[model samples]
Target: MKPEFENTPLVKAGKRFEIEIDGHFAFIDYREMGHQIALVHTETDPELAGTGAATAVVEKTLAYIEENGKKLLPFCPYVFAYIKKHPDWKRIVDERFEGYNKL
Candidate 1:
């Protein structure tokens, strides 16, 4: 992960966390709930697919959540899979999340 790919506040209210690579944007869409956030979706431009851009965006987003002391409700399947693959990030997951143990 690179600092250059950290949180990009380009979108208002911080609903989007994006990483720009080679002019393509890979981003995660989220909704804030006080100290918790529901990661709703992850998207990468078609041209950027399979380039690991999605992974990087998720990594940065998770880092942002951790750094800000926010709990995660990973509603997005991609994000759920990411957590399943890297269980260490489970620490930031909201324990009350319905699928908590699945990750």
Candidate 2:
């Protein structure tokens, strides 16, 4: 059975969306550049490895970006991979940066 995470709420703390797990944070760091939000990195505590914390944080960040009608620049490899696996998110990607997907 999958381990059930506590109701760890995702928080938009300044430039990142984060979730607290086992006293550490799992987060996706981002920066707003004009009309685009650049997803720069994702990090999870070593203790939270193998858990779904990273995925959860990414999902939440994507949803937040979508809801705000913002474009995306997925500069982070993990964010790029996640959006590649989930094509629906491609709609929000900035056209200039879409070339990154081909790399």
Candidate 3:
């Protein structure tokens, strides 16, 4: 059975890492550029893949950015691809921020 991840929370693990399921993490790597958080890398376990967990992480990260009035730098390939596919969140993006082409 697919894991129920709709209610999972994005928990910050460190300065440049965050995870969804405690030790069973969906890889996340990011850097803080001034007030913005630049996504370096993000991935979900193969077993948890395609379940929208990564999207949840992005949503939570965006919310965190919004709450802090900061911008987003989606450098992670997965995240970059996600935003590229979902233009609705473009408003939260800081084009002036670095790491855009890094995707």
RMSD of each: 2.9, 2.7, 3.7
TM-scores of all models? Answer: 0.87, 0.85, 0.74
TM for candidate 2 is: 0.85
**Count of clashing residue pairs in every prediction:** 0, 0, 0
Which wins on TM-score, candidate 1 or candidate 3? 1
List, residue by residue over 1-103, the lDDT tens digit for candidate 1. Answer: 4555454433323678887777888888999989998999999999988777888888878888998999999999999999999999999999999999788
> lDDT for every model?
0.85, 0.83, 0.69
Candidate 1 residue runs with Cα over 4 Å from true position: 1-14
Two-way TM-score contest, 1 vs 2, winner: 1
lDDT of 3 by residue, 24-49 (tens): 55657778878778888877777666
Taking all chains together, the TM-score of candidate 1 against the true structure is: 0.87
- Model 2: per-residue Cα lDDT at residue 17: 82
Worst 10 residues of 2 by lDDT: 1-10
Output the number of the TM-score-best candidate: 1
Residue 35 miss distance in model 3 (angstroms): 1.0
Best to worst by lDDT, what's the order? 1, 2, 3
- Model 3: residues with Cα > 4 Å off, grouped in runs: 1-3, 98-103
